[model samples]
Target: DATLLHSNGLTVLPTGTDNDITLFGPINEIAPDAGIFESDIAIRYFDGPASASCPTTTAAATLLRIEGDLIVPLGGPATSCILQGDILTVEYTDPTDASGDPNTVTDSATFDLRNGVLQSDKSVYIIGADMILTVIEPDWDRDNDGAETYDLDAIEWDSDAATVTMGNAGGEGAAFDPEPSSLRETGDSTGIFQVVIEIPNTLAGDKLERGEEVVLEYTDWGPSGADYVGDEDEDINLTIFTSNFGATVELDQKVYSWTDKVYITIVAPDHNFDSNLIDEIGNSAEDPIKVATRGTDIDPYKLVETGTDTGIFTGEVILTGFTAHDADGDGVEGDASGTTAGVGPTDGFLAADDDDGITVSFEFSEDETVVGSALIRWNIGEVQWLEASYPATGTGVVRVVDPDMNLNPEAVDNFDTDVWSDSDAGGIDLTVTETNEATGIFEGTVFFTVTDESSGHRLRVAEGDTVTAEYEDNTLPDPYTTADELDITGTSIIGTIVPPLERAPASGIRVVDAFGNSLGEISVDQQVQITSDLANGQDRAQAFAYLVQVQDDNGVTVSLAWITGSLTAGQSFSPALSWIPDAPGTYTATAFVWESVDNPTALSPPVKTTVNVI
Candidate 1:
């Protein structure tokens, strides 16, 4: 092996590029419509790459530069500062390319140093775009020879028609206007340049479809003259919705104009019912049908009572089931019974046909037993079907007829049904109601009971007294306190009637003056102070104090204001000087005097007065 001389070898080489240094000069500028000292531009590495030094000619390099201007300074310059409104033209180029390359392209950038720095707060960073340059120059002359002049250039300009769209892009009155630019320079790097551009409102853009524009106007309201700059240009983006125009659309069709009950339906692929009744429709189907009647008719699924001289009466409901399907190829049907099918007053038993769909109905009668506001609700449940057996060998029989085996398994279907009326039925809630029997005024007070919806506890509310109806309190039957009430002098109750009804007493607030006179008109800027034990933190007493300032047809506060405080029992308070009018004029002040204390229902009269202010 030693005799075999291996002479086939290779050598390595070092081939890499060196880093490069470059010159970076940023230019900052300001917008022409600068309300104050505003910078209108930003400096960025728009296109060129950073500088680089390479051992060879093939290396990456770039030059960093900036361009912009400065406009109106809100405040005057520091003391002794010579102000010059003449446009400042500052441009410089580094003699050597910072990329360390002998052959490199030159890039230009503008700079505005009116605010001492090359950048301004109003700088807008456009990721990729041409450089926009500007500089603020004072309208002053150093020579002071009675003649002052400065040269400048116009950077940008445009003109176009204002476009207005009625709706959005696809809506009405959509049009476009040509936006053009016009710019001119008075002198090269010396004099001031003026550019006149016009931006039309009707431009093409998704956001602009609603409303957008670049408005140009002369800040000085006086007639346009040759010496002044055109009104500042403004860019505003806006959006308006169809609903803002009073357009309305409904998502659901089941609407109640007056009072009709509505029920939802679900079905399987075919009109046939599921053997397991798994397709039966009801509460389990997850579609709770909303009542269509708008209070005029019997509440949906609720038993309502009809009034008659013979006494109170009750009514019942008759039910029928139907089937439907999904026309699309989604394999899902909207109308189908799930779990339970077929019906006969049995709970969970739906009248559904195995081949198609079955229907069943039940009639109820009105009777005195079903007195005022009472009803029985029912909700159908689910049904299940039996499955066929597997191999016959598992049953100890390999051939012949296996007693435990299912023959023609496909031919036989098993289903279960349990149907009946439940007071707490999950679906199809029903209510029965009748008119109050006891009429005519009562001699004294009537007692009643208010039971809680949750705990079933009873609380007594006097006649005319207000009480809150809440589900947490077992008052679910009366969703709103409006539905929960006790019969004052009637044998029949307005709400769900239970034993031991409670009574409620009426209460409210009122107002009066110190001399027992009704407060007429309280003057403007007048403070009506109410001092009494009632102001000593009584929970039942509620007092409001305010001053009404007189206003002219122009909506200016022209008169003194009126003030009011608490008014209860025989207690009294006095009035003091109120608010000072912003403008001098003759105006009337009105004070509304009232209390929501012991007398919770009564409202006090308003007091008004006229005052003259210089």
Candidate 2:
């Protein structure tokens, strides 16, 4: 259009004829419309010195202006105005990201804002608790100045009760109206108003139920009654919550064997209100959780928080089967049964049998309790002998197969059994354990030990005696016996005296020629026999290792051989290993005997002789 001069004197910095700034005719103009108008403004510089900042250029001088036309429809100024907020964007190069294009960011000082905003401090409010519904009217503070929540003199409520309709979520319950004049200011001149709604907790008279929703609807009214809506309404939806432990317990495995470690996980939503993971419940202290093999005698177990703000807890408990008599029958056992707590690992020692039930419970609060259960089964265990029979001086190997037993490859799962001569009934206690949890096979060594003066677990018996190994399966009930035995007869049926071997070498070794003769002289390309005359000098059969080594004149071994087998009582044998000579030289032959190749213990002094390989 055209430029009309107004008396608001606009001036430049220096007041002079050459420096004074003059108004120019408009290049583009805007007429108030329904939508926002945007454009840029520029200043035309005339007759500027030619320097590095700006080079001399002869361009036509012009001016331009950019603006967003504002329009208020509710009323005129003083009564209502548009709450406008804008963002000035900029793009610049960042040294840290040189290879990428220029980075763009929003101006932090400014953000988007609007009117008729409604919100609450919390998402869900517990039933029977106090709730505050906040309302923000940007038009009330359009000038950015503060306004009170309740203005008695203003025609805001029309001198009548403000009807803010409160209803259940999804229209589940009947609409309930809050108290009259419930509107109040949240802060001084904050322009934020809130209506405090008191929720009833009494189940008998309470109109709201757990899992229900709460909706707040508020409409502004001028001189009209609160029932009249001046414009669109502002509303918010929230949830009605209930307080309790509400935790779920899960066992890592559905089935477990005796003496196995039970892993437990408990997930309780909203349990930890704080952001930190330090919060705890049903812990070792306060109200300690218990996982008992029986119903009455609950044992204290340890549980800890899994992570920050997770509301999840994890723990591990060891099951003591019937052998340990760790159970809490049908009665109350640990502090889990009480309203308070107790210092404990487990108070009740009630024995648990196979197919017994395990009780896990905790006291979340004095009024609330959480309980869970699992199954404990211990099958009838069976034992197997590594051999059919054993000599009086031989060791016995007992392998127990019990799926009800927790097997650990690391050899931690261990249990005790007994073996004795059935004739004398003098039993010796032995420890058997599982290796390789996948296969529930346990093995232990039963040595034929000597009769020491003081005896605790000593089984001294001669040949022909029947050794009975009894596996006490505690899983069996009282009416049924728990003893399962395996009777193994001694190697000899006549009670004879067999030979016994030492832990190390008991005889000497020697080397012989290929024809089984003493080493003397051997021709090139001829092989010589190296042998050791070993005998079972004791009562029992013993394992033996015989070795023969042939070396050159410089003491470097050129040939080596060995023979391994068992030597029975009073048995004599000669083991020979051969060595061939390739070159004509003075070769030395040496033979040695040991307990076994695995153990290089010299059973006898090594003997050597020289051979002429020519």
Candidate 3:
């Protein structure tokens, strides 16, 4: 039986050319960090004499990792030694194997060293997107280090070494050859040479399309007049990665007043890898987008790019409401309007009204088009209670939105509204005011009273009564968006229900400060108020006695305090009594509500809680 260790001796990276074969492994892959460095790992020319690229009989590997490809160079533009029989061998020894002696392991794989190799280094080639492919010439490494690196200025190129002839090899392959394109070196004599091939749409003419296939082939068959020795060639079969294009439309706001401007935005894709169509969009031969609302076209209002290269476009128009204010309606879209608004696109104009959707659309490459639409709506308002329930004595908070009144916040308009209650037909007439200028959110706080009618700060309400607040905008039509809605007269209603008499009067004790904030624990001799929420839920007022008692661990009452107060109908009030803990000990504080101190008539349940003094 053979002992197994965690080392993985051989693995090759995928990128290959005639020049190099990269192996990046043989570490203890199962180790904590996939790294167990050992000096035994080595690389060699499988079974050949030591050549210029290899030093000793066995050159073991040192860079052991799955990352950073460790390239092992092979001599060839097409070296005869690079035949199917030629191979690179890697070996490693694991001294820690279960076997008492050092265990040796070996692995090998064959790689290609082509004469003329094509390298794009991209997983995808998007059509209409420009890309560069490189052609590497033969390589020679006299230094016995398996890496294709020449001395400071080892190999250089100054002129055209060979002509590259490109042709299509899709569908039925044929001998249809086009004019030859020259292979340009990136710099002087840097073996890496580049060639530019245009896709069917952009720089490349009518040679490609969405569904069809386009094959690009470049060959250097003969040893030519270049800086290197042998000739190389490559066949690259590419399936055009075509994409269906589309766009989206949005408005600043869905609804608009008769005089409000409509802000429009359009985001369309140009079917390119990166946003390279900035030069063609926004200021294209024709308007990139079209806008229409009331059954007619509106001037495209010189759409502009949203950013340096975002492909998103935006344009704004003053809603001049009419098919055209005069006979100017039937004019053309930006077909006649200049590309800039400063100069004025006087011919084409669009006026929007509360009608069908405002449509903004654009056609992209091919006949594919994208359309975005939104309807112009009536400026109706909305009303909502901050919370649906509140005690009759607590404040009722309502938020109002009246586009007609809130539309202009710089003036900070305050509009009168009504908050009526079920208990009384007549209620408080409240005026709502604005706070945040940008959102124009109007809020009105009304202190609800049981039987008193109050102004801005008061709305008469009762226990279990429904408080209704209706903010009406007379500019909106009752049947909104109708032809009769030329006027805004919509009503927004919010009805809040006061908490009912779910339970009778109750009292509870909490050690609190002067501000009624609970003091979770008290120090010895600390004077704190024991408070209770005393409330009356009757149709008539009631006199109540609130009492608090503290008992020590011995069950003897150490402190007792009481208060008498009158609670109006549906009124919630708090009463407090002072208590001083004389010593550090465990105590329980209990509160009780009764008819009076003399008449011990319990009106509700008494509440008790344990308190710790530290």
Candidate 4:
């Protein structure tokens, strides 16, 4: 029986030869039930010509006739329907019948025929009588597909390309490195790709404890084969700021004494967290991180006495296992005279049979000890006992022996050597007094006499050998408070001496103290600049008194030189400019105003401005 094809297929070649044509079989084969006609007839097919020659026999057609709905068989009923040998037609049956399933409608003679099919085996011009069918799978739903979420670290990222690779979960933990083609191509679109990175809580537990930064880098390569070379790679950095769960300790001062209580605090950056997240020991468990603060014990140490009269006393205290001292003891001295009766030692021991004559010991009160000295070690006993003392009397020398006598063993007078006298012992002479009054005013004078014991005459001490005067309440004033008062002020400039060709000239200022007191005066050599047009020093000086300047409190330059010669206070000076500028060069003219060099001498900064004599 001839098959009833649904659709047509064709092949058009340059020459309609037998081998140039293609063929397809009938697709809509049918079977029916009764006169009512039910058929497995969801069939569809393609139709085309069979050969290159014109149809000489029966003309092929996709027949659709039914015989009682059982077997609807049809084929080409005519022969020699003239057609061009080079033209073969193709047609299709049914809109969505790509698979040609045949289980639905019934077949009948009135059914539609899509097109003709062809066969080329015999070259008899069999046109459009054949059909073919194939099966296809159902479409898939992409949205409901299952996917696994992964952490940042769990994904393998190629640092070189700055890309993240997906990994398999609940398997061997294998990573899926996608090909470059898998990345979405960017062009007329915003080509931005992002990945979520989660930081681990265990890392940076001390600084953050709760917060961590999972550094993430992303890069993108431009499209390949673009019109022009592009700087396509892009880098993106992300940071997550978080809090720290730890303790902090601060101190009032760097050095702490043993008597002071060490202060500390224990707190977290955030107080609220699940209890399970807090770490207790080694910070492993708990919700929030736990913090503890402690301080070190300071050891109290005494000030060690280490020098003679008029010397320094050194001391130290250990704090937090660190050693610090009062800037190493220097310029130290001691006086054994004070507490001599209790702490001073004698010459030597005298045995039984010796009558070494009477030995008298001199002593002083603890309050009479010198300021920079101490009376220590009267006897080598438990305390090694020492006491701080100051100079009570005005500048006097205390001697260890008698005066006006040659009592030494080798003296011309040949006096006893055991006893202390002018010839045998040297004396310490003091001549200064200090007052600890709050006003810093000390009223005292030093008196001393140089005598020639043998001539019974008084020796003359040089005028400058000793000075006795009441220094009054002289002290350096506070720099900050006094600086802003009615005092001498000026400016400074970088000057150049043309005649000498010096890099910088001597430019200075003159100033005076609060009480019209002058600072040290400097009288340096001055020079003039020469203009190239003028011969030697012949050019007339054009004084620009209008071009002067001053500085404000914030050190900003301001035009305060309206009255050029007048600065702050009564100090003023004239800048003399008489010589001509022989060359085209720059020169600075400085005006200085200073006070007399008596008492507190004051100097002012130079107020100067450069003039280009061209």
Candidate 5:
């Protein structure tokens, strides 16, 4: 006689063998009306064969009747029965559900079963009409002023089938269908059903109050097809809280010139605690607002705290040392200035001040929405003091006039214009008439005119006042030669008496006449001389001359005269080449001296003397 045994107490089974079972029973019992005398036995049925030794079933149990002659074999049937287990307690407990507004709410439940024959591993199920979820917090109102309530109209059940359904009832929603594929025997009666319920975003409130809670109540079905005896319904409690806030930054002006006085004002409206503006740190004193700027044309400068008004803090900053060259010439400099104001101390805004000449105080409006007008002014006195002296020419007429209506002459006098005044003559107006042929002195006539200071009208000077004009040769060193004018028949000569042979052993030639000087008129053939003493050790030198016809702006030159020869070193030679021009025009006679006629290594630099051919 075979006996049904508990799956957990299966030590009675044969060990180390397949323990295959063969049942031979009567097809029909002799007792005619007894309904074939079938004896139903409880046994474990695995969807597939048990992996462990026979008799130790890893699957749930099913009832099988033994009345007819039947043969049971492995791998032939999808379901097979092993030994049964003693009945044990099965219950559901620990349901949890939570949500944050605008987000999904997740609900879960657990089934606890102990010491029982779990006939169907898929015993856990949720009742559609039994799940009740509600918002517990009275102040958790989102849609209306009344109490906020959440119904389980939209519910999602986590199972092998992953079934979802909708209901109109308060919390009575969809039922969870068992997933057979997910069923497996756990130690002959110990198994758990974990139910995951999801409330979609559609049901979640568009807005939710902070510090609110939700309660979920649901009944779970176990193997007996009844509500869990100990805990008829599982209750899940969940709380919600705030997660995020808002902040913003604004500015007064988008663009500013380097010299513009920018007004920066920072206002934090959100910082208003109670009726007054105060940060979380509790300091009511105008919050130290930091204003920073970033751009390409700006020099580094510090944003110093100038003062404050109302809840807005004020700071001054100057954009100095503009590197942009003003290529567009818009008068207003072109450079991008990006200013960002944040809540912080002034330490972060301080940088090494370059103190460039350009500076202006800037103020920003509260809320950074309006920028104050920028008044940029120059430090004229400081700038003029640092500037270099003005360059002056030997002879030029100076006319004084006031461009600005400000009658004060301080602006003009600051440029050292008074240095040109004649102390003895009261006021002097001199003109250059002619130059002396022998002494090379400039002769000029001088007169005087006085101006009525208030009306700026001219007046005659006192009769006996004599304004004598004198001259001094403050001629700075100039490269000679390259005469400005030359005569057709006149001789153009450039001479060098001494040579710096040690520094430049190789010789070079240059014109001795000052730039723009006339070489005299040339009516006929003219002689051009280049004279230079050769170095002491030089053996010989070669001289070359060319009369080049000056071209117009198109730069065309024609050789009028070409001469080349050799000369002895350490001796001065006058290479007086006769240049007879074919036409009267501006021409340059250039002379070159080389080491020798054949070798032609340069002994002197080329000298060009201009001649005017009439």
Candidate 6:
């Protein structure tokens, strides 16, 4: 009996104790022409009788087709040529589904072209194309096993150009045979062939001139060596254009005041090559220009681009105030003049009338390119540039009157007092009393005097001349002093101390017995007296004593009593202290004087009265 098995192709054999069977038929057949002949084959089993048919039948197998078409799937019109340095792609597909699974059939491709002229080696195309070709292959099981796997492949374009080589997806050793003009079985499993070709500028010479056309033909060779063809030829055209760009800046006002608004315009010629206001080339709508004073230590201000018109950008930077100058060598301007303080006025003011005009500058930059310009303007001027000016003499007069030389209003006028006389003119002598240092207050006498050409007699102050007084306080204990110009006006000025000063009075204490008698010896449990007195001649008459201490023979001092009371000038206070001693010994008593409970003064001399306690 004869048997047939079906698979990708056909297979025939004899079975059932028919080892000596002779079978004649097609073994493997492909579409349209080759396949298994289901009826024509004859089989002879065991050499007994010749059988024209098989007892058992199997499925029929189909043939594998490896033919495909090459196509230029992407890029441009079929008649248009690609740019000199542009990319082109070629793909291949199967027309005949001979392999049953047409999508899984592997394929390859190759290109043949003249680098202007063909080379001696047919396989070597001398095209100065200097092309970089990348082949994308499908993942497949080359061994035809049940398990599917993939192999990394390499590509060699222009074997002479050692630098022009392509590595497989795994970047391992060469995956394709460089000797043959064939692409690897690389591509998706769709029986497709895909390859990208890049022509570098360095290789595209005058031979490939602008407006010239070049043709590239690619062929798709199936994995089984069957060839197919379709849109394999592609045309590439060359075109070129050059670019020239620059920029300039202009201001609405050449000279600006501190209160003025700075309007800036930037003209960038050829910035928009297409002449469209839109930012196509990324060169439009650049950063804003920086505006700053030429020689002032001020933070630079940015004039942001508010809008653009025909490649011209407009921006504005509003100046709130101008930088100050230390004209009087005091480290700050207008401090003594009361012109600009705190946030300062937006109206700019020069230190003096003769000062030079301030120079304002504008700076523009993009990337590494930069440009700048400057203009001079006065603080007070017309729309145009001008210098500041002031009068030679002031119009207001200033004087210091009602001098409290002794800091006492009730005292009569004394000849030795440092008094200020009513003066009309020439400079006056001013004095500052010694400051309390602790309270930060002082009194001074200002003598208004005038000079004469002949007699040098006293004169009254004239109008238009001003005298200003300034003071400095040493707030930080003994070292640092911060000065400030006092804002004073009118004829009489009286300044008071922040914390009033106090004078410690002279005090003395006397120790006496409790019986109102002067006793030398006293027994334990007996009482004694401590008398505290304030002298009449002292600056202050009142005095206070807070503590009274008693010392025994062993030299151990104990606080016998605590007194918190005040005493008037020439007044005496006698307080009874009864600190009974447990042991027989001699004891002495003393008192402590304090200017006030909060302010402590020197302790008064101890007034001792010896007593024997037994």
True-structure RMSD, every candidate: 37.7, 20.3, 23.9, 33.2, 26.7, 25.7
Cα lDDT of all candidates, in order?
Answer: 0.23, 0.50, 0.52, 0.22, 0.28, 0.33
RMSD of 6: 25.7
Alpha carbon lDDT at 275, candidate 6: 28
Task: Say which prediction, candidate 1 or candidate 6, comes out ahead on TM-score.
Answer: 6
TM-score of every prediction relative to native: 0.19, 0.37, 0.41, 0.16, 0.19, 0.23
What lDDT tens digits, residue by residue, belong to model 6 across residues 561-613?
A: 76666554444455445465566687766655565557666435445556576
Clashes of each: 121, 21, 16, 66, 32, 22
lDDT leader: 3
Arranged by TM-score with the best first, the candidates are: 3, 2, 6, 1, 5, 4
Error of 1 at 136 (Å): 99
Local error of candidate 1 at residue 206 (angstroms): 68
When summed lDDT is taken over every stretch of 10 residues in candidate 6, the lowest stretch is: 381-390
Please name the candidate that would achieve the greatest TM-score relative to the true structure.
3
The model with the greater lDDT, 1 or 5, is 5
Q: How close is candidate 4 to the true structure, as a TM-score?
A: 0.16
Model 5: CA > 4 A from native: 1-231, 246-614
Better of 2 and 5 by TM-score: 2
> Which ten-residue region of model 4 has the weakest summed lDDT?
376-385
Order of candidate numbers by lDDT, starting with the best:
3, 2, 6, 5, 1, 4
Report lDDT (Cα) of residue 556, candidate 5: 54
